[model samples]
Target: MLRGIYISATGLKAGLKQLDTVANNIANINTVGYRADITVNSGFEEKILNYAGKEVGKLEYGVNPDINYLDLSSGKYVPTGRNLDFALVGNGFFVVETPAGLRYTRAGDFQVNRDGYLCLPNGSRVLGEKGPIKIDNEELYVEKDGRIYNKERSRYIDRLRVVEPVDPVALEKVGGNFFVTAANNVRPGNALVLQGYLEQSNVDPNREYPALLESLRYLQSNARGLKVQDELLSKAVNDLGKVR
Candidate 1:
């Protein structure tokens, strides 16, 4: 009875975790450059049950969430026709200087701060080869290779510092569509930059809705199993052991 209760509890926990993951994906469906998380579960090894020093049967403990990985697949490119907007065509992240230190992101919706520096919507300064890109003028052109040139003056400004992680799986999400990792984990990236585009979120509602329903069903099933085990335990301890 106790073993059954333990198994059901584990199943409930795993189901809740899966539900949360799917819900988050659905919530971020409209976010720019959002990457969906995928959860994987692994079952505990079956143990042989013994009674009076003799093998009886094998008992299985329920599964648990093993790990979560980002869906690295690229999202669709959206054209905004704004010069400051940028998007990567391949693997890479745009480097930005945040208050918490340097962070990386795929979001390319950028604006120029009052300090004449190009920055993300959250005010994180966008980094270039020389540091924060100072865009004193709006008439600038960005090349596919990330080079920025002053159109009116016809002078070179700097190249955007696009980078890729040495171990992408080691990167952690820090919210607001940013990712953080050790400085040594990054390397120069080869992704092409589009000057007037943004990447849409990679979440697919069609898949997430079905996953959410399935997780809810699993949770409800586990809850019922747990209640059944508890009632059986109560009956065994109270009614069955009564001295009538």
Candidate 2:
């Protein structure tokens, strides 16, 4: 009875974790450059039930949630018609300078800061090959190769710092559409920079809605199982233990 209860509890925990992940994905469906997370569950270790030194059966514990990984799939390109907006075509991430440190992101919804530096919505300065990009005027032109040129001044500015991490799976998400990684990164060979566009979130509502329903059903089933186990345990302790 106790083992059954433990199994039910584990199931409940796993279900809740799955629900949280799914809910987060749904919430970020409209976020720019957002990547959906995929969750995987694995069964716990199986133990052999022995009776008088003879194996009777094998008992497996409930499921456990494995590490969640980013989808890494490219999102659809959205044309914003804004010069500050940028999007990547092939691969790589735009580097940004945050107070914590340097971070990588695919979001290119940039704006000029009060200090004449190009920055993200959160004010994180966009890094260029030279350093933080300074936009003195509004006539910014970005080539497909990520070179920034001022059309009015007819002068070439710094190139955008786009990098692809050695191991993208090792990258961890920081808040505000940024990712941090310890792996070495290199310039991508085929990534194209498109001005006046942004990358939409990779999360698809059609897929996420069904996944949400499935997660809810799993959670409800686990809750019912937990309740049943609790009731059985109560009956065993109270009614069954009563003096006849």
Candidate 3:
């Protein structure tokens, strides 16, 4: 009876965690270049103690389990023909300058602020080889290689700094579609810019919605088990008390 209670408790915890992930995904359904997270579960390993060349003590599932792992997969690329928009054809990240320093993102929805400086939607300055790419004149163009040039000046000013980390898990997600690196280090990669295309959110609602429902069902089943256990315990206690 005790073991049954414990197993149900673990299931409930896991179900809740999975539900959280699903909720987060749904919340970001329309988020540009948003990637949904998936939870991976692993069962507890049993250990058996041996005494005098024979098994004496047996181990069972742990009282608590820790889950840590979020797989990063590329989301689908959507086309939005906006001059300031861009997207990674392959694996890469666009670098941005935040108050917390340098960060990265897959969102290419960029725009020029009032000061003629290119920036992300949240107003974070987009980093380039020559710092933030600022165009004095309104006339400007971004090359496929991420080079920002002026047709009037006939000069190449700066190049967007795109990077890809060896271990993507090292990156952390910040608000406003920004990602911060663990050590603030960036890996070398292509920084191609598309003048008239925006990247789409990578989350698949069809898949995530079903997963969310499944998690809810699992939680419900666990709750039922817990109720059953409570009733059984109550019955046992009542019988013991009727010792007259």
Who wins the TM-score comparison?
1
Which 10-residue window in model 1 sums to the lowest lDDT? 45-54
Candidate 1 lDDT by residue in tens digits, 45-77: 422322234554544577777677899899999
Task: State every prediction's TM-score relative to the real structure.
Answer: 0.91, 0.90, 0.84
> Which 10 residues in a row give candidate 3 its minimum summed lDDT?
45-54
Between prediction 1 and prediction 2, the one with superior TM-score is 1
The top-ranked prediction according to lDDT is 1
Q: Candidate 3 on 1-244: residue-level lDDT in tens?
A: 8777877888898888888878987898788777667777656632222123554444454223345344456666666766677777676888888888887888888788888888887888888887897875456677888887785648888988888877877666666767777654567776456667766777788898899999999899988998898889889889999968
- Of candidate 2, the 10-residue stretch with the lowest lDDT total is 44-53
Off by over 4 Å in 2: 44-60, 183-189
Off by over 4 Å in 1: 45-60
lDDT of 1 at 212: 96
